[model samples]
Target: MAKKKKKDAYIDPQQRELRELIELKKMQQAAAEHPEEVQAEFEKEEPIVPKTFKEKWKNYWYHYKGLTWGGLAGVVLVVWLIKDIFFGPEYDLSVTTATKYMFSALNDSMSSDLASYAEDYNGDGKTDVTYNEITIYLDPEAENVDVQMNAINLQKLMAVFAGGEDLLFVLEQESYDYVCGGKEGIFIDLSALYPDIDIIEGDKLILNDTALGKKMYLNGLEEDVFLCVRDMGGSVKEDDESLSTMERSLDFVENILREEYPDKFPAEEAPADNSSEEAR
Candidate 1:
C-alpha cells in the first residue's frame, strides 16, 4: 500500500476524521493478511494531538506532587507570617524585674488590677502588659559563687537588655545604677513626669515607700526595691513602641502614685472600735 505525503496545509475536521476513519478501516481489513506491515503504516499515520491543560496538569502532578505541595505550603506559611507581622497584638508595656521570686506568681492579681490603668494600645479589645522576672542576687564575680547559676542569670539579664522592650525595671537599689544606666541612670526622670510629687531619685521610685511596695511586702525585705523607666527624660531615642509604652507607663505610675492607691490592693485598715461590743 502507498502512503500519502505529509502536507503543511490544514484540512477540515469532519473531512480529516472521515478520511482517517476510512484509512483505519481499510488497514484493519488488510491487517488479517499482513498484520505487522499494516500496524507499521497505522503508527506512521497517527495524528499528533495536543494534550489538554487538565490532562497535562494530572501528569505533571503525578511526577512532582512533593515539590508542588511543598511550594504551596511555603506560600501559605509566608502569607500567614505576613499577616501576623503586620497585624498582631503587641504588649502595651513590659515589666522586667530581677528579684528572688517570679512575677508570674502574682500575674493574675497584677493583670486584673493593672488592666484598668492602660488603654488598649494593641487594639486587641483588652489591656495587656508582659511580666518578666529574673534572678541575680550576688555579683557573678563574687567569692564562692555558683558559677552555673550566675552564668544563667547573666545570660537572662543580657537577653533582656539586648531585647530593649522592657519599659520598666524593678531591681534592688544597689544593682540599679550598675545594671541599668550607670551613675546617670537610663530611667525617665519621674520628677519631670510628676513635678509635684517627691519620689526617689529623679528617675527612680522606692517601691518600699509606696502602697505598691506594702502590698508586695517590700518593707519587710532587707533590700529596698526600686522601680524605674528606661526612657531618659526625652533625651533617649524612641523605638517603635517606646513612646507608646512611655505614655502608658506614666499613666500606670500615676495610678500607682494616687493618694489613696488602687482600691484593688488591700489597704491597711484600722481595727473596728470595741466600745459598742463592750457595752453589749
Candidate 2:
C-alpha cells in the first residue's frame, strides 16, 4: 500500500540543437565524399535522348535486312530496264517472219493432232490409215501480207493434191457484188464425228456438231458436206474400190489441169448440164 512519486525530467534545448547539428554535419560530410552518389539519390532523373530520324532509319534497316536488299534490287531493275530500252531482242516486226511463225504454229498444231491419231490407229495394236484435212480462211478485212500468203499456200497444196478430182476440199468464197470479198473461207466439217458442228468463218474447226446453229450457224452446202462425209454418219472406211476410184479421179483431174489450165491446178469449173446431173 505505498504511493509512487512521479520523477520530473529536465530537458536541455541547446544540447538537443547541438545533437541535430552534429547529425546534419555527418550527413553533409558523407555526401561530400561521394557527390555522384548524392546526385544519383536526390537529383531528378534526366529524360532519355530521343532517337534522330537517321538513327531510327538505321535501326529499321537492321530489323529488316531484306529491305536493304530490296532497295538494291530496285536499283538493279531500273538499270536493266534502261539497258533493255536502248538494247534488247531486236524488235522484229517483219511481215515475212510473222507470217512464217503463224503458219508454222498452225501446221505444227495440225500435224501433231494427226500424228497422234495415226499412232492410235485401231483399239487393237494396229496402224490404221488416217487423212488430215486442213482448211484455211482469209478474212475480208484481214489484209496483212501474211494472211495472203497463208491463203496462197493452202490453195497450192489443194491444187497439188486435188488435180482434176472429185475429192472434197471445201473452199467457198462469199461473193461480193462487184469485188471478191474474202469473207468466205474453208471449214473441215467433222459433225459426223462431232454432232454439234458450227461453221465459223475461219480456218479453225469447231469440234462439236450437236451445238450447231445453237452456238454457230452453218451454210447450206457446209451442212450438207458435214452431214454427208465428215460426220460419224459418213463412211470413214475407204474400200479398195473406193480408193482406186479416188486415185483414178485424182489422176484424171491432174491431167485436165495440166492440159486445160496449166497454171491453176485443181481449178473449179461449172459442170456441163448432163455431167452435172450425172454427178448429182
Candidate 3:
C-alpha cells in the first residue's frame, strides 16, 4: 500500500489532459490547412460510365487489353488450323523417311527432282511434294542417342501413317523389315505400280542409279535405301479423295522410274564431280 501511494505521488492529472488537448489541436490545424484533403476523405466517389461507343471501347480496352488481344490471337490461330487441315489440299505427295540420307525439308534438291515427275494433282498449277524425316539412329555407333528426340520422331511417324494411306516412305532395310518386310499388304508392291521399270524389288524402289537419285546425289547413304508407297487397298481410311490421290501418286512413281540418265552422262549434268565418294 505504501509503494502504491509513492508511485501515485509522481502522476500528473494536468499533464495527461494537456497531452490529449495538444493532439486534438494538431489535428484541427491539419484539417484547417488541408481542407481539400479532409473533404476528399469524406467525398463520395462516382462510377464513370462512357457515353459513346468509342469511349466505351477505350475504357474497356484499358481494363482488358491483354484478354482481348489474347482471345483475338486464339481465334485467328483456330481459323488458320481449320482452313489448313480440313480444306487445304494435301501435298501432291507426303513422304515419311526413316533414314538419315533423305534431304531436309528445306533443301529443294530432292523435291525439285521429284517434282519433275509430279502432275499438278491438286490442280493448283504447281507440283507440291513434302518430306517428313524420322530420326532413327539405326547405326550402333551414332552418338545422337537422345531419348526425347527419339520419342518425338516416333510420334511424328505415327502421325504420318494416321493422316493418310496413300503416302511415300523412304526407309532403311532394317527399318523396312521392322515395319513391313515380310508383310505383303501393308506396303504396296512397287512391281504393281512400276511394273515396266526394272529398279523395283517387291516394295523397294532402288532410288540409286535413277535420274532422280543421280540428281539427289545421295551421299553418306552407307546402307541400302529404298522408296516405298503405303498400300491403300486394305486401308480403312481410303476415301474418294485418297483414292484419287493414290492414283496420282502411282503415276508420279511411274514417271520417276521412267526418267532416264545417259550412260555417258552430260558433263554439265553437274558441276564437274568435285564430290568425293562420301558425296557421290
Where model 1 places Cα greater than 4 Å from the true spot, the runs are: 1-89, 101-108, 113-116, 139-146, 232-240, 259-280
lDDT of each: 0.69, 0.39, 0.71
- Evaluated at residue 4, the lDDT of candidate 3 is 93
The candidate that wins on lDDT is: 3
For lDDT, candidate 1 versus 3, the one ahead is 3
Q: Where is model 3 more than 4 Å wrong at Cα?
A: 1-80, 86-90, 139-141, 192-196, 233-236, 261-280
lDDT digits (tens) for residues 119-209 of candidate 1: 6777877787666667665554557656788679868976776666666788876457546655464677887766655555688777876
lDDT of 3 at 55: 97
Highest TM-score: give the candidate number.
Answer: 3
RMSD of each: 17.6, 25.4, 14.8
lDDT of 2 at 85: 76
lDDT, model 1: 0.69
Q: Which candidate would rank higher by TM-score, 1 or 2?
A: 1
Model 2 over residues 4-108: C-alpha lDDT tens digits?
222212336777688889999999999999899988876677754439998777777778889889999999999999897786533111011111122233344
